[model samples]
Target: SNQSLLTQLLSGDEKFRIASFPTDLPLNGMGSDAPFEFASKQGLMTVMRHVHLVLSRLYPNRPVFMAGRSQGGVAAILYAQHYEDLAGAIAINPPHPDPELFRFTVQYLEDKANVLADLLHAPGVTLHDRSWEAYKTFTPSFDYPSMRSLSPILTLVSLGDPFNLFPQYAHALKAFTENDAKNQLYILDAGHNLWNRKSTDTYREVINLQAQFMVNQISKVRKAC
Candidate 1:
């Protein structure tokens, strides 16, 4: 029910108009018993349904861009893959639903459990089943949610994100948009931990970058019309 950490941070920039909220009751660190499927679908649909609708009504003539961090990032990318209601979408260090990702991330973490669920469990913070099951067998993985078919999204990568390094971030950014040349892949010189002071500053920079990208995308769209 609260605005996301992303919103809290981005609100500092008065130049930008922000309308950020939880992707679902399950995300936003609220925690949920939502099974694998519901966790994935609910997050994406909340944006497509509630958030987008609210923003569209508020700014009917304005192009709306969506951006999310981590799980929220996954939702943003997934929403764009299925719908064209957004002007553009940006995902920052979105960890894919891949078992290998967790397995690989273990080498850098103190907890080395190989079980996907346990490996990712954050105790009382948030996230469902550590998202391992959803990553492995979610319906989207089987039939429709192919990154290859996704519209161009600004995916920012962190070379230091243990769970999703720049190289592992490849598959997510492999897809080309209609304007192939504009599918920009930016590698930031920072880690994925946005909780600390240093990381938080980097996140601020990322938000600024996202704001600039959105302005450019909106301009291009207006020009094409």
Candidate 2:
């Protein structure tokens, strides 16, 4: 969704091949129905399945890395959880599915009742009821192996960004990866749209930092392999 806005960042990077999947899908739609979760599993499965097919036909035994931004970030992480072959992942401002955070965000938006929420109904866009219900399913003690088990998940957040800021974001990061020193967190100095010029080039700087970190991660992985 935000990929179009991020074209400048996504483009001109040939060293690492990038693929974009367009949709509001989630990792698995077993019980929830948010626009993102509703389509996530199918979209990720479809993308990975195609990648598998392509690799099978071309170089059958090659390794690959996956990364995603916004909802795409969630998809990337979900894809890695399901696929053991995912070498590494770089997820930027992935949605935090914590119930309290979700509630707070909804209340915050509803309080503002802005055009954005009115036009789109967002996050809870489709399955507003079901998604809220599903969110309640999560608890402080809920076990999230998918997040914590991801050995090399790199999470980036912006201090002023309402989307990724919070106990929920913190929990999501913790859930996906542990407190190991291997985990790296980068805090940018702007709001959600870092690439925006109004942010005084903070977004571009974040992009450069993320790129360097990704390169270092790849090099470390290569050495380990």
Candidate 3:
């Protein structure tokens, strides 16, 4: 679905050797506590470690680029912040860095526990408490300034996202890349997930645009080296 954005990037560029993995979040409507527990700072670190190990083994001394959609986008940004060796990153429609947004999401999941369970086909599922606590500590706002020192990045924000926070996230990224003209904040005319409410043609066009953006950024990184 939305992941096609990443897939398209992989297909669009031959020079880029990218890897994709699941966040293992509980968005499948499977009604499992896994989603809640997996949505934490520790969980993200674990995933990033795995990513680092895999890329280090495969690419050795080569520079690596990271990209993701939504929560995946958040993970990309977080990983880039923690690891300075990355060549760059692309985050599409990432969650706001504000802790309150996470708190609201946790509350909404709790309040709509039954409704989510029914929708996901998990009749007795509820968001786990530990998961909620971990999520609270996963805020990214505190680190944007620090991330500014890392490699170049490109952020894609959809203007019509229902969450209404992605544009703010994009702006935050813009501030982070203020002095660096190579980094960019690209605004698209679509929903939270660009493919979600768009037509097939529009979806393809968006994916193509993202692929081109990634190619350009990677080219810039390559030339500067």
Candidate 4:
């Protein structure tokens, strides 16, 4: 989803490669006897570690553009946070999990028809307990500050999204990230799916802007080198 548009924006002129990590059990449920779920905070760190290894082996010298939708978006930010060498990060409708926003969004969903709880209770929901626990943990008391010193974090969201409530997030996350490197948030007219053809196209435009900025920065750095 991110690659197709990223390529389109470079006028079909840039080279982009994509890889995905297979989902693993929550740490220990599958084979090892170590608890499947470890510290919640460490989850991001674990994923970033894998990304660092992949980049080290695959593109030792080339710049990388990291992008993802939803959870992937969160992972992208986590990756950029750990790996400053990332050229840029583009995340769409990413869940930020701010307490204030989470409180309000959960209320909105419950009032809208218990969609929040229903999703949590869904039979097929993977990591259901962990996800719900995380959801509850994010309810208005947690100090959720946006991570500073990360690569450019561009958040693409939909104003009309009934599911994610990106409208409520723009301010909360932005305020937390204002002092960070080129942090940005853009809103579209569509719903939760940031990759819907129209919404995805709009999201890509923002990615293009960030990519250009990163490219220019890289050029300057290369010249200095």
Candidate 5:
């Protein structure tokens, strides 16, 4: 289940060399902070910087594409926005900055503190002070208009997902990229995890579609050169 959509793509396509990196944030209890800290702007930026540094050193001359799920998806979008040389970005179920959602998540965590503690069972699982500050400062939804100027973005959203606030986020992103023919927003009939269906048919179809889009974009760039 840890395998992502990008992983599926890489396995199916032999011509493309893909790299997947961890967020390296405490959000998943992998760090000192409690779960969900990685949802903050600070957490996202930290991962983005790490990704940029790695890519710069390892594949400086090669065209790079970013793709991810949930918070990782948000990071991919942000990275694509900052780097003009990126071929493109594919974000699945990304969450935008919404004050109400933030408030709701904080409240949910607070109410479920004991449950979270039991689940994570790691050191420094308490909420970090910086997370709250980052929430107030790093709202990406406010910058959607500027993001329209960045590289092409393809957003895949699931209509059945009511838990992650993705529909609104995808709608706003689609609006920003409305004028760009290269950018697209695709809606799926599943939930937050698009590949959760018992039948692999839907998952295979989505992955194939994404792979085709990425190939087309890469071909266009090569022709332009």
Candidate 6:
């Protein structure tokens, strides 16, 4: 699904190697790495920090950028919130990290006829109890103004995403973010998934725009330095 997106980011003859790994979070489940406890947001960030360290070490000369979609996108936001060393992050349709908004978004998915099961995880008519437990692992807590991060973020959200009401979010999450916070949100024409499947044309365009945003952002930083 993200093949076009990844390729576009690596376009322009750039030597960007994505160190893709399955995050032990419920989004992708366990991978080859020995599974450890990471039910809390603290636990989640602990693993993410290790991944950042490895990336920084492996590519010492490069500015590290994080990007992800859906849950992965939330991970990217979480990453930017904690790490000033990051160059930037691109979050595509991440659910809110606030406890109320996040929980509401979760329930919206549950009510919407297997959207969670089909789109977010395995296909099933009913979301399992185990799935709910995965979400319980995190005690969601994030405030835009108090974030300890300095890196900028580019957030892309679909205009029609019912799960996270854009209108309501604009007052708090979006409006507050613009009042000096580094995160930037851009609305797209697609549905909740951020892809124009009915129109069938924007997946590539979305990726290209994201790539361009990254380039422009990096260029500004380099010039500033």
Question: Quick one: best lDDT, which candidate?
Answer: 6
TM-score per candidate: 0.63, 0.60, 0.61, 0.64, 0.64, 0.71
Cα lDDT of model 5 by residue, 52-129, tens digit: 678878877666778876555666677667667778888776655556664554565556555554533333455445
Q: Point out the higher-scoring one by lDDT: 1 or 2.
A: 1
Lowest summed lDDT window (length 10), candidate 5 = 24-33
- Model 3 C-alpha RMSD vs. true structure (Å) is 6.1
C-alpha-based local distance difference test score of model 6: 0.62
The 10-residue segment of model 3 with minimum total lDDT is 23-32
TM-score, prediction 5: 0.64
Q: Comparing candidate 2 with candidate 3, which one achieves the higher lDDT? A: 3
Best by TM-score: 6
lDDT of 4: 0.56
**Mind giving the per-residue lDDT tens digits that candidate 3 earns over 1-225?**
336655555534443455554544432222235535444555666777787778789778665677776556666776766676777777776666656555564565567665754633435655555554554455443344454435556777776654343345456556656755545677776654466443676677666776676566566667887
Candidate 1: segments with Cα more than 4 A from true spot: 1-16, 25-43, 97-103, 106-145, 148-152, 170-182, 194-204
In terms of lDDT, model 5 sits at: 0.60
How large is the C-alpha RMSD of every model relative to the true structure?
A: 6.8, 6.9, 6.1, 5.9, 6.3, 4.9
Query: Of the pair 4 and 5, which is ahead by lDDT?
Result: 5
lDDT, candidates in the order shown: 0.56, 0.53, 0.59, 0.56, 0.60, 0.62
Regions of model 2 farther than 4 Å from truth: 1-49, 52-63, 115-147, 165-168, 171-176, 180-182, 197-200
- Of the two candidates 2 and 5, the one with more favorable lDDT, higher being better, is 5
Query: Between prediction 5 and prediction 6, which has the larger TM-score?
Result: 6
Model 6 per-residue lDDT tens digits across residues 115-211? 6555433345344455454543443543333464467888887756565564664444565357646777777766655454555566766766777
Cα error, candidate 1, residue 214 (Å): 1.1
